[model samples]
Target: MGGERVGRGRGTPLRAVAYAAGGVVLLAGCASMPDSGDLRGVESTPRQDTQVRVFAMPPSEDASSAQIVQGFLEALTSDDPDYKTARQYLTPEAAKTWRPELSTTVLSDVPDAQPDRPDQDDTGSLTYTLTGTKVATVDAQQAYAPASGAYNKLVHLTKRTKSGEWRIDEVPQGVVMGKSDFQRNYMSVDKYYFASNTPGAGEGFLPTAVADPVYVRSHVDPTTRMVRSLIGGPTNWLKPAVRSSFPPGTALREDTGALTPDDRGRLTVPLNDEAAEVGTARCEEMAAQLLLTLRTLSPAVEEAELRTGDRQLCTLSQKGADDVAGRGALHRPGYLYFVDDEHRLVRIAAGGSDSQPDPVPGALGEGEKALRSVAVARDERTAAGVSLDGGSLYVGSLAPGGALGEPVLRSRGKTEEDRLTAPSWDAQGGLWVADRDPGEPGLYLLAEGAEEPLRVRTPDLDGRVRAVRVAADGVRIALVVEKGDRRSLLVGRIDRSPADGGTDEGQAVTVVGLRSATPELEQVTAMSWAGDSRLVVVGREQGGVEQMRYVAVDGSTPDVPPPAALTGVKAVTASEDERAPLVAYSVDGIVRLPSGAQWQKVTEGTAPVYPG
Candidate 1:
């Protein structure tokens, strides 16, 4: 379990003295403020006639932020531990926006008792303290009814739709709840600009210098709370206005330092001061998001710094990776991938030119150039090298030292073996390699640290092999094959009887039948597993338009209908969280799932890679 902070109740008064009678002036770059009001006693009172109901609506299809939080709380009591309800609330676009989060799940211990039935209790109360909020925009077009509240020994619940009108919703205890009045006012103008969009910008408050947009994000374990890595953004542009920092919930105001540039020209903002002031828990996440939007018509960085009173704290920056040489190219870089703890790939990033391109503007510098080269080298399997995990990174590749010259690896066999292509990791801590062995072309598995190979042959497989991916659990593998100008999908499960422990039958369940027998998919290039049974395949259609398709593996029940069809998928990568499996596809530029409600442009033009 992680650290916990206990709030007295929803209505506890905010503590801490006000900065001044005039109210703390938020200098342009300064975003920090001292706690006002009585923090220790802050609380909330339930609405009148507090009737609660437990609605059994379907889970979100894409599990956006709202669904994620709701599903998480629901898991604490319901007998059915699924995310279906979460998915039901999302529209196709919104579902796709939050598709990644849909795959992740949270487990909680059930309470000993639940509240009484909805018909009886007006106020719904539970014993556990709620710590987080889920925000989601509901659709006005759809109408949903809340379920009847049920009480057992677990939790109490009563709920009903608010006047039968749909509303994009958030938890009652969410941050939005506190600022509801302000939000109502702000939205009244139809739109309000945040970050660079704020008017009247200038230096010290708003200036101009930026980092390309596109940052790698990692989430905290057990909670799925996100922690964004500040990669190649312009740190020096807004170094002066830095101030106090906060972790998830704690705030700090003292001891923070300045931002420094490393030998590689990368910026390193000292977090020691912010950590000391806010405490590690909250300050750790304070600077996790991009402080300012670098790209704008005017391009001015304002309030560029986030100051907490007198101290110059964290700096601001822009984000994005650049690839000057690879600009305008349409190739799948297999760079976005994830594996188990041992560096064995449980999944792979699947998508092609049909996927989207990076949305943020910017190209890679010389250091970025060197790092990307090494990542490809480490991912090579023919040379008996180590497999790379999406979560487990190669630090040397990201930040090199001395003249070791970019951490390149040696090739296996005669120094002339065909260049390694389509390299991927498997769940059993092995590397899956595809090649043509003298008229017999197929895929093979190379276990960790084992030079010798155990071949995986599927004689029934026809045509040339396009791509292969091993599932997270290592229970099955997805293989794309082309036969007679037509493509087909095959799911092969290791066939071993309870008694016959030695060899495999080499049998596979054909997933593509009537649908896969089309000539339009002739250009199929790659495939990735999105879930235990769902697969995302990338290929070109009749017009050479790139496309990504989803299929569910159900060999035992072949009669089941196929998955829904979705196009405009450019490049798809497996998300760090299984519940939110696919992400960051590009159409013209790269667009990724930022949360459940929006698709953020992460990069534009040829995408650049952030070292490590």
Candidate 2:
């Protein structure tokens, strides 16, 4: 994941912390701070300002059943705070029962309204089959997961006795909005959660916060809603993997109003009586969580204070939050490195610079053995690489006078991607390699000091694992898998056994819940984790050129401008900092952005990387 420090990240990632008690302040050390040089900036084309249409009155009284169906679908797309206008399309009785916040079904296109019986024009029943792909679904609990196939919905309408209006009788709760409309009406937000601080990678128990991406009402006080959702708890899938400092059943004091920050960027969350039962330390934990979650907003709240009615609790400032950020738990490598023409590992400084590529000290620099792809350990003292023939994997020390070691893991496949993929190092110092062996493809894990690699069985990943990068968390893996001609980016949870009773490498660290993080990218050639929870992807659509953009692991792509272009790129890499400029190995050479200034060439290299 080889460099020592990163420049400032893309956005100020959610470095804020959460607490349980009153502001005693936490001590979770995140990452090693790197001296950010002049941070490179991209002068992206300005975003087009567009005004969204809010909900209007319901369909007219004389509207047809199909008209009402189509109008209701369009109304769902509108940024209506309450479903009042949409309720107009529904029967008075049904309006009171329907709940649109249950789940958000995001379709690639608008819903296609079709009569169950096309021949019956006066029939009371109509179906709105979602068009394009389902893309992803955001449940009522604010959990986002990638979903495929169709979202065919049946809606029944009954004529209103008083107004003679064609009103929807029964339909599912939650809105079904088109992707375009979803983009306009909803916002992609991240609520923060604490990483499980189990000791690993010889670093002991270091804590860090992870971002859980979800969609919310963009115009609605989104910042406050994020806090509300945080108190509600993490999604079902991530609950086991993450920790929340807030006490269970903790909620905002106000049941209906949106929690807002003051002009000083201080947001105070008023909790229920449950907070009173909790201790002061726990109160600080609660405040830390609020600080981290609220800071993800556009106009971020810099500080958070907890309260019960008028009584003030602990206050968590940015400094206290930063103190416990725990980001450093996942070490960022020191420099940008890649395989040179001589098949030796070489290096250059990160960020936008025209630094000459130099051979890294050690066996990798000697190029005694031909190397295809390589990954450096977080310690910067060891490396793993795939042989030029793609038949074997090798790990050696980066220290001076070291030599390439024997094959740690080997492949028996026929294709390049199958035989061996790029080796990756996790924060735990585990070396991960994928054997594409089309005949019996599999992913294997090898921890430091372990002799044999343990086979990792992943769901639906039969022989399709194209690239593997272990995240800093050490418990998750990001794989670029190919299915037919289409490629999708997915993140899988690596659930290790309850205790360390078995072989470290062979221990059953089950890789479960393979969720798509970049379903929109038609083909993903390479990818790297940008921050604690975000990923920088290198791919193109069905016919687009290789480009790079940032995407959240929950299949949520940021609403920023188009990604920077990397012409003829075969692979890409970036500093752990989300804000750092990306480095790519185009057909020409190694390139880094704000290309607006110029994607300065570092050298001729591929597989440039930093310690994961």
- The model with the greatest lDDT is 2
Compute each candidate's TM-score over C-alphas.
0.30, 0.81
Report the lDDT of model 2 for residue 51.
37
Q: Write candidate 1's Cα lDDT for 508-532 as tens digits.
A: 3221221231223566555555433
Per-residue lDDT of model 2, residues 1-612, tens digit only: 011111123544222121223312221111111222221111111112343334433565456555566556655655467766678778778889999989888877655544454444444444433334587788888777778897776677665566666677888788876676677667777677766632352234545666667778876567677878888888777776778877777787756477777899888778887676776666776777777666656456778888887788788887687665555333445677888889988876655364778888887788878888888887787888788989988888878997676787878887665688888887667788888887878888887824579787686564378889877767568998877888788888777664356645435666788888877678887788776667788787777676778887787877766455657777777655655667777887777775355566777777778765
Model 2 error, position 39 (Å): 54
Superposed by TM-score, candidate 1 places the C-alpha of residue 167 at a distance from the truth, in angstroms, of 53
* Candidate no. 2 TM-score: 0.81
Measured with C-alpha atoms, the lDDT of residue 60 in candidate 2 is 54
State the C-alpha lDDT per candidate: 0.30, 0.68
